[model samples]
Target: MKLNVYADKMSQPSRAVVFFCKVNGIDYEEIKVHIPKGQHLTPEFEGILFFFLFDEAINLMQKLPAIADGRFKLFESHAILIYLACAFPGVADHWYPADVFKRSKIHSVLDWHHSNLRRGAAPYVFNTTIAPILGRPLNPQAAAEAEIILSSSLSKLESFWLKGNGRFLLGGNQPSIADLSLVCELMQLEVLDEKDRTRLLGPHKKVQQWIENTRNATNPHFDEVHRVIMLAKERQQHQRLKAAKNEGGSNMKKPLVSRM
Candidate 1:
């Protein structure tokens, strides 16, 4: 069965799915949920009638039995990743393990994703960036407080989770879903201004090193994920340079006027 993923460009969950598929050589088709265009909110894309039941899209998946059968199928990311790893043996060893304890450890990462990381980080970043662009201004104080909380959590993750005595998150051999989930979340830090990136990710040398390593690695895809990130970063820098030039030009005019 071809895995179908519904995602927006900047979404961390979506990126994790894409990264996993690419790294594992899993075949899938993507259905874009372009939040900027208000596409995710549409009946065609977001409607429970059209797709699987996720926590965010649970109501929509209620009607489709073929898609909603809890037996012989799983919709949650952790469940799906485990299912995929077991089904595709040649994929990789680091993702999920046959060992019961090792497998349970991997599942814990997913559980943490829903409760801690998503709760702490996702909303703060979304409200800070996407909300305003979508015409909703979340309270500034709430956003700031959320960032601090999220950053603190990130610091702990750096010290303990991502840096957990392995070359990757699962252990020293390679990476697993745990690594992907953490990396995907770290990718969101790139959206912040320079100061925020330094404050949030810079102090975590291991986390920063892993991210740099992944960006340098290869993935089999028509469009690789990090390539898109690099292009976006370059574009943002260009815009900043243009704005600086205009400000400089205005300052030059003021000096000339004063001389006159």
Candidate 2:
């Protein structure tokens, strides 16, 4: 039986899953779930939708980017990556090496990511970009706090994880599941204005290089999966320009105040 994958490319974890499948030649059917449209909440999607955890909130049923292979079912991006790497005999070893110590380091990076890198990056992007798109008020204070955390996370990622001459995390020459996971999370910032995105990521040159390396390594697949985000960014730019034009026209229409 073929592997069935339900996901939305716009989602970080979902993109990670898609990249893994594409890079590894894993044959799977892609099922797109439009989360923003409330499609995931529908009864038909209850079991296949992936839900992101916010604060203390958790929904046990939401599972997106999920896989169903014959009788087996799996959720969680890290687990799915590891499972694909291990389950397929022809997959490259570097993805999740058989060497115990190297594998342990990869695992460590994955675990630390949830609480540190992802914690900082995901919230920062969503709060600043997604919330506003959904008609929610922007929270400057919260976004600022998340930015500080994200900056610290990037620093650690550069100094500690991608230290020395390594192109990927944990000093690995090849990209690992950890690299894909964190990179996708950071990719969420593409929705921001170019200046803001550059300002947030510019200080960390290593991170930037790593992103390029990962993209090069993954090639067309990575770019293909990220097309959704690129489209969204373009739409955002169009909206901003239209809004500014409307405001300018309104201002011109207002009569000037004459001095008495």
Candidate 3:
């Protein structure tokens, strides 16, 4: 039976799952769930067991990047990646190595990512880019705190994880699922203004190189999965420019009206 994946490419986990499927040649049907439109809230989605929902109001226990094969279902991107690696024949070992120690190291990075890198990175991007676009209240204090945490997380990512003389995370020459997961999380920052994105990522040369390396390793599949995000970022930039131009025009007209 073919696998069914319900995902939105705008989401990091969803992109990761899509990338994995494409790179590994896994046969799956892509079901696009438009989160902004509230499609996931409908009865059709709710009927599915283990549906990967991505609402902030939902409990944290709910999983995302979910998959289904027949009646069986699974969620949690990390678990799903490992499952794919293990279940599918001909999957490369570097993804989820059979060696107990190597596998444990990969597990360690994945576990650490949630609370550290993901916590800092995802919130920062949401606060800076998505919140403003959605007309949600922007919390400067929260964004500031998230940036500090994100900076520290990047430091650790550089000084510890990628410190060894290896191209990828955990000192592996090839990219692993952990690399994909974390890279996708960091990629969220791309939606920010170019200045902010550059400031946040500039100091971390190694991290930047690792991201490039991972993309190269995954090849056309990585870029293909990321097309949605790339388009979104472009649209965001256009919107910002338009808004600024309107603001400037309004400011200029206000003086003329006041003088009259």
Candidate 4:
């Protein structure tokens, strides 16, 4: 199976895919899609999107239908994750537990991720961390609202999700899908300002340690992952600053920059 990933190295979902691929020692060609350049909106992307209109990760999903002529198109990072876990069962047991109760527990974590953590936390990361770098600070009210939600969500994860000592989520055992989602989300939080850092990752020792552990999972690749994630965030921040300058020069109404 040829796995062609169209991803911006800086995107969290893309980073998750990269993390998954590295963990599995999977050989694949990574096609960089420059989100900052708006390459995702290009004609080629439009064509790919048209093929898989229902799926945001169209470029990768569309290939399955074309190559095998089966119901192969897939979308959503979570869905792709489940499919990969089932398809490559031997690679890593952490993503999909074999035990029935463990699997159910993992599903619960994923469901929680979709409804709570992802919903609450992602907007803050996007608005403050990415959008500012993209020439726009988020709307004042929206950013404030997102930060509130993110704080509460972070608190919940630290207080409840990390209750055990198994090295990751799932009640003190090895990492499961829950841990993966949490790790990816935490990666976004690492780019935040002091207040957010304190509100999100500061008090969460487990989450903090998990981040450190994932960084050095494999000798050679550990440093690579750290380098890639940090570089991506820095580049995005720089771009946002440049965009902010351009926006100011253009006299666009700027949202008052404030940290909650």
Candidate 5:
């Protein structure tokens, strides 16, 4: 069977997976999972995981961005990426290179990304931007706290990882999987109002440049994959505008009833 990549583009990791697959000319079919419709939890997803015997950590979660290669099933974007890097022929060496120490270093950055950058960015973006679009109240307090963590994470990446000579992470001229994953994660911030987004990212100038560098390196594929995110941002902006207009209309005073 051909490789099957199950993904929802709205998901950061999912976008990373799809981007990698597309950019590398890997032959795979992308099965779209409409996450907002709760399709990820459907019986169809569970049906494919009949052989769910991978380690507990990688056990199929019936989540977006999983892959099925023959009888083998895998979840977790990082695991899938590593698997793809090794399993497929014609993948570029720079992505998950043959050099063991470099591969380990990339893994180190990915590990930190899950716990730090993703942790902070996901909830922070949700609270400040996505929550309201989903009909949940935006939580300013949570966003504020999340910003502190995200800012710290940015500082760490800028200071520790990207502080050296490379245009990409870990001093590499070409991007690695870590670079793609982290940049995709940061794409969620595009949903924020310009002022808010700029304020948050403003301090980390190097990180900003790194992002552009990654985008440029990936070129057409990167922008094409991220069109989903850009569309999402547009939809959210429209929703906000409509909501504001409706609120204003409701606030306008009606003519008084004289007989009351």
Candidate 6:
């Protein structure tokens, strides 16, 4: 049985998992779980649709980027990326690498990502932009707090993981799952208004270069997986403009027009 990757492109981790699969040429089917529509709340049991109703089922997964490889079921994007790198035959070595020491370092980076960087990046984007789209009021105080953490996290990456002479994280010439995951997380900031986005990301020069390098390494596949977020950004911008015209200069959170 081919691998089935259930994911929502809008999700940061989900995009990383999907992009990893696509970049490595893993044979898999993408099962989209559209979160904005609440599809994740009622996921269909793939390959066994009628085995049990979604309401009655006790063990059915309820998350983006869950996967079923034959009988093996897995969630969590980092685990999925590592699994694909090790499970697939044609995956490049630099992704996870064979050296235990190097792999351990990669693990360290991933650990740090969730503990530190993600704490700020995810919520900052959520409170600042995604909140209004979800019919929730924007939380400037929370966004402000998250920005401080996000900026600090970027500085750590610059001084530590990205300190060496190489382009990628830990001074490596190639991209790894850590790089992919972290970069994808940062992509959430793309939806921010230009001034805010620049203010947060501009000062980290090494981090900026590393993002570009990883992006180029993954290329078409990287951008392909990220198309949804970019689309969301475009739609939000258009909505703002139309809202301005229609509302006659009222500065309020206009509803995010559904262009997905």
**Candidate that would win on lDDT:** 5
Model 6, span 95-183: residue lDDT tens: 99999999999999999998889999999999988987667899999999998899999899989999979989989999999999999
Cα misplacement distance, residue 92 of candidate 1 (Å): 2.6
Q: Ten consecutive residues with minimal summed lDDT in candidate 2?
A: 50-59
Residue 158 lDDT (model 5): 91
Tell me the deviation in Å of residue 98 in model 2: 0.6
In the order shown, what is each candidate's alpha-carbon RMSD?
Answer: 4.8, 4.7, 3.9, 8.0, 3.3, 7.1
Measured on C-alpha atoms, candidate 4 has an lDDT of 0.64
Candidate 3 has which clashing residue pairs, if any?
Answer: none
Clashes of 3: 0
TM-score, one value per model: 0.77, 0.89, 0.90, 0.75, 0.88, 0.87
Model 2: per-residue Cα lDDT over 1-260, one tens digit each: 78877788888999999899998898988878877776666754554333321222112356566776655677888998999899888789999999999999999999989888888887788778788665678787888888898889988998899899988998889998888989998888888878888998898999999999999999898898899999999988888789989999988866778898
RMSD of 3: 3.9
* Model 1 score (lDDT): 0.63
Q: On residues 148-238, what C-alpha lDDT tens digit does candidate 3 reach at each position? A: 9899999999989998889999889998899999998988888889999899899999999999999999989888888888888899999
lDDT scores in order: 0.63, 0.83, 0.83, 0.64, 0.87, 0.84
* Prediction 5 TM-score vs. true: 0.88
In candidate 2, stretches whose alpha carbon ends up further than 4 angstroms from where it belongs are 47-60, 251-260
> What is the C-alpha local distance difference test score of candidate 2?
0.83
Deviation (Å) of 32 in candidate 2: 1.1
Write the residue-wise lDDT of candidate 5 on 1-260 in tens digits: 87878888989999999999988989888878777666677765455444342333222465668887876777889988999989987999999999989999999999999889998898899998888555789899998888888989989989998988799999999999999999999999998887888988898988999999999999899999999999988987888799989999999998788995
Model 1 residue 32 distance off true place after TM-score fit, in angstroms = 1.8
Runs of candidate 4 with Cα error greater than 4 angstroms are 48-71, 216-223, 232-260
> Measured by TM-score, how close is model 1 to the native structure?
0.77
Backbone clash tally (model 6): 0
| Candidate 2 vs candidate 4, lDDT winner | 2
How many clashes show up per model?
A: 4, 4, 0, 3, 0, 0
